[model samples]
Target: MLTRKQHELVCFINDRLAQTGVSPSFEEMKEALDLKSKSGVHRLISALEERQFIRRLPNRARALEVLRMPERPEKKAPSKVVSPQLRQLPAPANDVIEIPLHGRIAAGVPIEAFEGVSTLAVPAALLGQGDHYALEVAGDSMVEAGILDGDYALVKRQEVARDGEIVVALIDDAEATLKYFRREGAMVRLDPANRAYDPQRYLPAQVRIQGKLSGILRRYH
Candidate 1:
C-alpha cells in the first residue's frame, strides 16, 4: 500500500497534468508540497516511476506521464468511511474550462452544484496570477452567498481558504458544493445562503477547499 504522502503526491501531480497538460517542475512540486529540498520531490517522483504509476523522461522538462492508475484497496465490510468529494471531472484539455455540476438543483431547496458539466471561455487576465479554473454555478444555494444560479465564477486555484470567503468545496468527493467558508481549529463549516439546507460541518481532514471564488459572471437567456 502506498503511504498517505505518496498518495497525495500522485493525486497532485495527476491533477496538475490534467489541468495544465504538463507536469509541474521539481520546484513547483517542492512549493506545492512544502518540501525543503528538490531532492525530496525527486525521491517521491522516482518512487512513483518505479511503481509504474508515472513515467519520467531523462533530462527533459515536463516529460512525466501517467502510466497506470493506482490500485484501489478493498473496502472492509460495514465500512462507515465515506468517499472523498472530487472537485471536478478531468477536462479534455488543459485550456478548456471544466465547471462543476453540483447536482440537480431546484428553485426551492438549495442543493450544491455538480462538478465539471458546464464550461465557459475566459481570458487569462481575468483569472489573475496563478489562477487556472472557472466554475459555473448551477443552483441558488449561494444566492445568499452573493452568487446566483447560472453564474460563471472566476476561481483562483488554491488549497487553503479564508474565513467569510466564498469557495468551491467537495463534499465527500461525490459533489462539488458551494458555500461561505469558516474554520475553527480542526473543524470546517459550509454556510449556505438558503435556510432549507442546514450548514455543513466537517472535520478539516474530510473537506477539501478546491478554490476561492474570485469573481462572478452572469448571463440571462
Candidate 2:
C-alpha cells in the first residue's frame, strides 16, 4: 500500500502524464506535493517504484509510468471526537462479560486474525457500550506501546477509525493486524509501536477497520 504522500504523488504523476504525455519534472512534482526540496519527491518516487505502483522508464530523466491506480475507499465523514471529559462514565459493575475471542492477531505483521472462535471472560469495566471482542496478541511489533505477545486485546466493533487511533485493520478481507491508524495523504498508514518494525501503508479500500482498541489484558503468571 502507498502512504498518503506516495498516493498523491502517483496520482499527480498519472494526471501529468495523461495530460502532456510526458512525466512531470522534479520541480513540478515538488510543488504539487508541497515539498520544500526535491529530495522528498525522490524518496516518494523510490517508494512508489519499490511497491510496483510506478516505474521509471529506462534512460529517461522524468519518465514515470503508473503500473496501477489505487482503488479509492468509500466516502464517509469521519465521526466526531467525543471529549473524554464530556463522556459520562458507566456505573461501576461487579459482573464479568464473555466476549468472543477471535484467536490470535499479529502485532508485527499482517496475519489471518480471525480464525477459531472461542470466548474470553472480561471485566465489564474493561469495555464500554459497544459490541466487544477479544484477540490474543501474537507479536512484539507493539512492544513500545506496552502490547506484548500473549496479551489479550479488547476491541470495540467499528467500521470507521480516526487518525492516530489504534484499530484492528483487516487487509484485503484476509489478514488482520493491530496498528495505529493514520491518514498520510490519500492512503492509509498502519504504524507499529516498536521502532524495529516499519509502518505499513495501503490503499484505503484495502483496509477495513474492524475495531478500536478498548483495553488490554495481561496475565502476570
Candidate 3:
C-alpha cells in the first residue's frame, strides 16, 4: 500500500504528464511536494521504484517512468457501521473522455486525414462533443495570433468553419494555409494575421474545409 505522500506524488506526476506530455525532474518533484530536502523526495522515489510501480532512468534528466500503479484492496466494514457526515462524491466528468492527437496537416491542399497519430487524455469538461485532432503548426503567417511554428494545435473537426474564425484550409485543391476563414457568395478567403503575407482567395468550389481551430497547445523546454 502506498503511504499518503506516495499517493500524492503519483497523482502529481500523472497530472503533469497529461498537461505537458512530459514528466517532472527530481528537483521539480521536490519543489512540487514542498519537501525540506531533495533526499526526502529521493527516498520516496527509491521505495516506489523498488516496488516496481515506477522506473528510473540513469544519467537522464526527468527520466522517471511509470511501470504500473499498485491496486487498492477493498475495505472491510466493521461490525458496528456508522455513516460519516462526509459522503464520497462522484468522480469528475473529464476522466472518461479520450482526445486524439492527429498528426500534421497541410494547409494548402486536400490531404488524406490520418487518425490516432497520438492521443491526450483530457477531462470531458474541457472538450465539446466532436472529433478532436492535433495539427503541428508551420510558418509565421499566424504569429500575430500567438501561434508559432512547431506548436501543436488541438483542432475540433468540423465540416463547416465559421467566418472570422481561424481555420485550417486547403486552397485551389493544392496548398494549405492557416488563416481567418471568410466567405463571400462564390469566393472564399484565407487571411493571414501578419501583414507580410498576402491573403489567399479561392473559388468556393476549389477550397476544401479540412478542420476548424479549436485550441492551441505549446510546449516549452
Give a tens-digit lDDT track for model 1, residues 1-221. 23334556787788898999888888888888888999777767765664467888779877888776554434231121111211221222235344433333322233454533555565332444565566656666655334567666666778888786667776666456767788866888877655545777888777787787665555656
Model 3, CA-based lDDT? 0.61
Q: Compose the digit string of candidate 3's lDDT tens values, residues 1-221.
A: 34435655766776787788688877888988898888767767765664456887789778777776644322432212111101221233535455666656533333444433777654443345688766666677665455667766656777688786777776566555666788877789887655567777788887777677765555666
Q: Which stretches of candidate 1 lie over 4 Å from their true place?
A: 1-119, 123-125
User: For all the candidates, what are their Cα RMSDs to the real structure?
Assistant: 17.5, 13.3, 18.0
Candidate 2 per-residue lDDT over residues 154-195, each given as its tens digit: 889999998867899999999999998899999999998666
The order by descending TM-score is: 2, 3, 1
Sorted by lDDT, highest first, which candidate order results? 2, 3, 1
Candidates in order have lDDT scores of 0.60, 0.79, 0.61
- Pairs of residues at least 3 apart in sequence or in different chains that clash in candidate 3: 94-123, 94-124, 102-134, 107-176, 107-177, 108-175, 108-176, 109-174, 109-175
Higher-scoring candidate on lDDT, 1 or 2: 2
Name the runs in model 2 displaced over 4 angstroms.
1-92
For model 3 the TM-score comes to 0.49
Per-prediction backbone clash count: 18, 2, 9
TM-score of each: 0.46, 0.59, 0.49
